[model samples]
Target: MHFGIRFYLLASLLIGAATATLYFFKGHLYSRAEPLPLEKLVLATPRIPFSSLVILAKHNNLFAKHGLEVQLEITATGKEALEMTLAGKADIAAVATLPLAYIVTRSAQPRILAVIAKSNYEHSVVARRDRGISQPADLQDKTIGFLPGTSAQFYLEALLTNANLARNKVHMKSITIQDSQSALLSGDVDAVALFAPWDKRAAQALGESGIVFAPSLHTTHWTLTSNQNFPITRPRVAEKLLLALLDALTLIGENHEASLDILAQEMEMSRADLDESWEQYTFDVQLPQALITTLERELLWIRSHGNVPSGELTPVAPLPDFLDYLSFSALQSVKPSAVRITR
Candidate 1:
């Protein structure tokens, strides 16, 4: 009877131990799982110089680190991507300032979250070897192809106006980047406004014939626009995204050579072109006072000049909208070691 009792006790002990082990492992597995507030975010991007972050985020798994599952969709135009956010099809969009400004003017009030990339007026009006274009003024009476209704178009127009060329003097064709190269080479268009990799490629293809005319003024803002309601509805998600973007922006500035290499791979451009492009780009994360002033001035100019209808130039409301959108709290929470606020 004692032997049978001993055997029962041994069996019970083993069963108990197994149950305890299972319970401990189950807790561990739960701990390893993603946090309760995980989010799935969709970000829209256009093919341009500022697309570095989109490329890096996926490759480096930065989003996953923050419990975010991100989907990046490359759209035909920045305007269309911005529209996706407005229509509730996208969670965030990395695009130019003009379209966001236009959307803001229309009363949708998409908030500017961060400045992704800024070019130092290096954008040029390039022409084919046969076009014989020398300056912005030469663009007059010539068919110039650009992304119409984009910041590039607006800036190019401003450049032409400053150079004594009127809008009526030039024939404008709305073209995409893929087609701009062929259009200029085939004599279908006289000139195209190209940035970075395209600029280098155009220069090589047309040789001395490719004339580059720098825009008269600088575009200091390449910004991100997001739906206001998203932040309100999903504050955690918005905060996480903004934090990740700022982190990415800072990385780009600190390690430009590496950043350019990443951008080159993403755009499928030669490193030499990427280097040339990097020289013209200013990757700044902080919204400087000068940049703010320039943006405000741009809004005023766009209104006064009728570049966009006056109703479309309505002042950016919820000053704190920008403030909240850039809140670094989530980033701070995730990686406090990365951010150093120096006095």
Candidate 2:
């Protein structure tokens, strides 16, 4: 009986060892056999909320599965994406509709391919209590700092409109994003208009002495744009990219925690911090019906705000051609319901 028991024990040990070895080899083989992305695409993304979807798609293997190898180049803001596209550093860019008004006028315009997502609450104003900026009304005659773009100008205008304050009531200062926090902390500006991680970090840096004002411009749309000549040359790749983005958007909608995890990782924010403001962002992959109208209004604001000369840029005459810049065939091919552009 003792010899029989010993033989059984030894046999069980050998079987367990062999099974473990086979499982390890099988996993290794599968990893080694994983196919590479058929096409490499470099995407330009502002280190803002809009970057989340593309980053998620890349990290979750959605792009690779769709045969795309995506490399994300971090930009200062959506405006920088357009510059990157024009300079040939990137194939696709994430640009805001407000900024597109100015960009569409460039001799070689960056073609807006699709709307990746829309968010009303992406930007915010963080003020220090020491500056006597406790309320919107208190902002009267106060100095404010904004990032280097019409989009930042857009945020400031919306805030002024909401407070019923005239443009002259608030002194505006243009500051680089990297220097904004220090500017605010040092009282170089009474208050600062910022977005996402920067605004959130500013609030945290001030602790109980900070006031975060969210005067959202509900008409804001985050869009995917391409270089002046990319989509026309490579329509099929652009289509595949749109399909992948649609998939990524679906994942973001259906799996909130998973998407948030990816955003937090890329944005370098703690999960808890991301959750605080994540709910405010709207994730959808539809060409908004109001996109053109919003751009028109944004163009007016841009002109009046003097970010660009109104006479030099004519959004009206070029508006129709700008609409043509969007290619909807790829979107319709993958998901019919998402094609909501009227005209």
Candidate 3:
């Protein structure tokens, strides 16, 4: 009986060892296909609430599966993030294309790899109900508060200019976005130029106290820009980033309510306001020629403001034709079934 017990014990040990070996090799086969270095790649982001989708994607391990380490830095504004990238202080900046395009126009080095989103009716000029402000044309000769060098500023300016109103017609004051809320609430400024989360907050604080000018202007929202000087640059990385974003975009569109819940939590806003904002906003990932037209309009304004001399320097770098930036190949690589929420 003792000999039989000893033989049984020996068989059990061999089986256990073989099982462990198989498990280890199987994991290796799966993971070793692309073994990345231990270090992580950092990406700069803004604290804006709409940015929750990108933040959640990182927390949910979507980036890790693609052999990437995405680190998020809460920046004051997208322009600040672009500054970091231009200074070689950050790996990637996720923000408005206006600032990034401005930077590239000033110095033709940083190449915009992919667009995060195209701006919709997000940027708006809001006023308290008491102010009786009804439209963009109404903003003329009034004190319009804006954070200069921001996408909001660009939109506001475009709206005003399109209305045949020059910058001098309105009393414009440059204020930080955080301060714009109080500035409007306290009647410090006649009107505040801002985007959602802020717009929702402002409207709620002063009921009927807010009005938005629709069909004013829209531009590229967030774009991923990389140093053209990076040694290991690859179009493939740009493609991957777009795919990840498109995945999140698909999820947001299909499950708007659930996505808004996520946005509220990430943005620290109430569910009611998030729903309100969502009703007015649209997020589409496809790049259209309208972006180039917007860029040309922006560059013309930049020249008018003497921000960049028209004759001395071109306002924008010669980018891949509008279609080139649209990576159909990248979109094709991501199986529709991988992130499809409905269709």
Candidate 4:
């Protein structure tokens, strides 16, 4: 073969190899198409048992299924969670009805989206044996630490009412949830109104010496709320969020055993412990009529506490339907049955 022919053949081979390499890389580029645009949301969680639906949603990628990326900000209490939402740090929050009631009266901007879970046995007034505080009545004249501005106050009030003790009769010390247990064990207070984990730990520590009285006679719901701006600016996102939560509730209802496993991990409690307390709660999707009645009753108590001006809101017989705060348009569009809260 001629030298020029050999060189030409070699050049042709090199060009073909380069062409094949380019095509290979081009195929890879197509395979790695642009990632889907995920809308981001900041959700404030109070880390309560009633918040298990939110926990399940977060853990199981339920939000992702709805094209959302939620950043969970674990707050100590629902009031704090709402504070984060107000401060522009969080878009949505899981809050107790009492705290939500307190804020909703003051600010006309926020709205309740949905109820995650409702529990009657989540909170209690724990008294120390050393203080001779054997019952809720013993809390009279006794200094008690409470997480003020949260459901702790309401729980305390309910317990006192049941015991027929006047609110002014007892002294209240403002205590954060983080310090509630230590404050009790260290004798800083005679008793404390605490929620789960703290409530469990306090009872366990006090053993036979303590009296644990659960004050929530009706229901304690961890409601999903928005900062008003979120629902107004991102209605679709809000709708999707509601849908995801409903889906989470469905999962818990249909596969209770699996839901328990998820709750055990999410609540950081033993399965047996959850089982014992399971009957106290009704974990399902419904805009219960009780929510309206409860809110109406608590709104009075909330007003009595009165850091807010009462005249700001006209005292009315029946407030707007609780559903007014909720946008079921999403639910209506997705599955009309989900919005069939009344029927």
Candidate 5:
């Protein structure tokens, strides 16, 4: 009887062990076989330093961590990126408030997702000292090159206004920001108002002859924007993207040098240039009250300069309700504290 009892206990132990082992392996196999699929998202952004957060998110795989597979569509300028988003080629676009303000006037399809970064020194006037343009007042009668219907023109005009120079005093040349450096070097224009790192490149190209003038025009806000229906249709996707960017912002705040390395590589810029200009930008995710104020201010500039073609809007037509163009629900749901807009 004692031998039988001992044998029975041993068999029971063996069965229990086998069952436990089988259960563990079964669960492991199930996990391996049916892994969760990542949602695909397309982000259109300009290949500029302003897009550092998006680049970091892509490099670090933060989007995947949040269950998103983000594909980047790089453009030469924010205007182009915004256009792509408007045309349905991309789901999101990284753009500045100037372009956002101008585009919304013609079409109300675009909506602001978040203001990712702001910089007081993003726009500047790089001129050759040989052109007798050492001071802001010297810009008078000098041919200043700028991209029409962009922040470049807005900055140039604001700089002149701050200097008490009239708009007609300076001859404005319509040169693309990409061509600003060559235009300046080839003497196509005495000075070029551009955004970084083009402004930095123009300054470096001129060496001792280069003089960079940064007037206190307005703070340029770099924003992530989408179509009017995107956030409503795919709220989870929008929230996930913002969460990924929030992670990127945290990483940037913690590891400055490492963040700069990622940005430098992504932008194809030297580490030194990126480092030098890094301090000028405040990287964060916020929908500030200033966004509305800035849009209102820029709209006035847009109307006065006739930046938009008359065919798009009649002269007497009231300005767009900037508030209507903003979509705050996604950011609010992800991080309520970050949404500073009153409405």
Candidate 6:
């Protein structure tokens, strides 16, 4: 019986030792099986079709596929998105050429990562027929409403230029996108210069009375921009973001139906409505020389105005080299062909 007791005790010790060793190995194995935490990024963008690529990236989990946890901060306009980025509220922002140029003229701290999309007819002027604005030429002596400091204002000016109308001939009213329809339907303004989908909404609201005038002046480049230090400090994050967007672009190019579905849901619009303006957008990841030309043209406009819509005139500074505002290394690293800028 004593011999039997000794054997049982020895068995119990061996079992305990085995159990401890198993647990030790199990802990290490479990740790090795765990996934590395994804890097977090905040992308600020307007809820428009121009931002379809980023939206699709989030919806399709491409960002996660690239090991990023992207949080989208939807803004009413690209101007707001850029402001959020400049204020450190977002890591990146999708903005238009106008606002980007306007801000770049003031400060060189905003860096352009890539031009994701461009549309020439995305902006339009919706005028009230009753306001005697049958044509763009009639816009003179009319009060026009637009979202200040946005591409809306720039496009409005372009429309006027196309019409041979003086900028001072028409009264420009500052309005928000939410107020555009009411402000127009109520006769608060004679016309509104707006970007899609607001432009479409305003036109539909007016029915037979609204006349839509496409700017067709210059292509509006929808771009991804960030604070100057963001890419410099987080190069990998920036590269991953571009990679994810490239995936989204491929999806957009390869499967139009699926992409349309994603964009419609993201923009909270019916597929039909999205389809109407679908052809206007050319979604791609590019850094073209046209971007620089557009910026320079907008800078000339800003300089001529002497003051942005924000407030009184300050003496404008000389144009900074726009190339300085564009960070090509990230795009060059991801897809060399996409970086078509001269410098």
Identify the leading candidate in terms of TM-score: 6
Q: Candidate 3 regions off by >4 Å?
A: 1-39, 49-52, 129-135, 230-239, 253-256, 279-287, 307-343
Rate residue 343 of model 5 by lDDT: 68
Per-residue C-alpha lDDT of model 6 across residues 1-343, encoded as one tens digit per residue: 9999999999999999999999999999999899979999999998898999999999999999998999999999999999999999999999998888777766648999999999988899999998887889999999999888898888898889899998889898899989999999999999999998888888999999999998578789999999999989999999999999999988988998988997898788889999988999898888998999998988888888764866735437888799888888888899999989886
Please tell me which predicted candidate would have the highest lDDT against the true structure.
Answer: 6
Clashes by residue pair, model 3? 128-209, 129-209
> Clash totals for all models, in order?
0, 0, 2, 0, 0, 0
lDDT of the structure predicted as candidate 5: 0.88
Is candidate 2 or 4 superior in TM-score? Answer: 2
Model 6: lDDT of residue 146? 84
In model 6, pairs of residues that clash are none
Candidate 1 per-residue lDDT over residues 60-145, each given as its tens digit: 67777777899887886677788888888988887776676555555666766556567766466787546656766777789988
State the C-alpha lDDT per candidate: 0.68, 0.78, 0.66, 0.77, 0.88, 0.90
Residue pairs with backbone overlap in model 5:
none
RMSD of 4: 7.6
Tens digits of per-residue lDDT for model 3 on 197-257? 7876776776765776756366545666666644245445555565666667767768767
Q: What is the TM-score of each candidate against the true structure?
A: 0.76, 0.83, 0.74, 0.81, 0.88, 0.89
Clashing pairs in 1: none
TM-score of 4: 0.81
Model 2, residue 136: C-alpha shift (Å) = 1.4
Ranking by TM-score: 6, 5, 2, 4, 1, 3
Q: After superposition, how far is residue 282 of candidate 3 from its true place, in Å?
A: 4.2
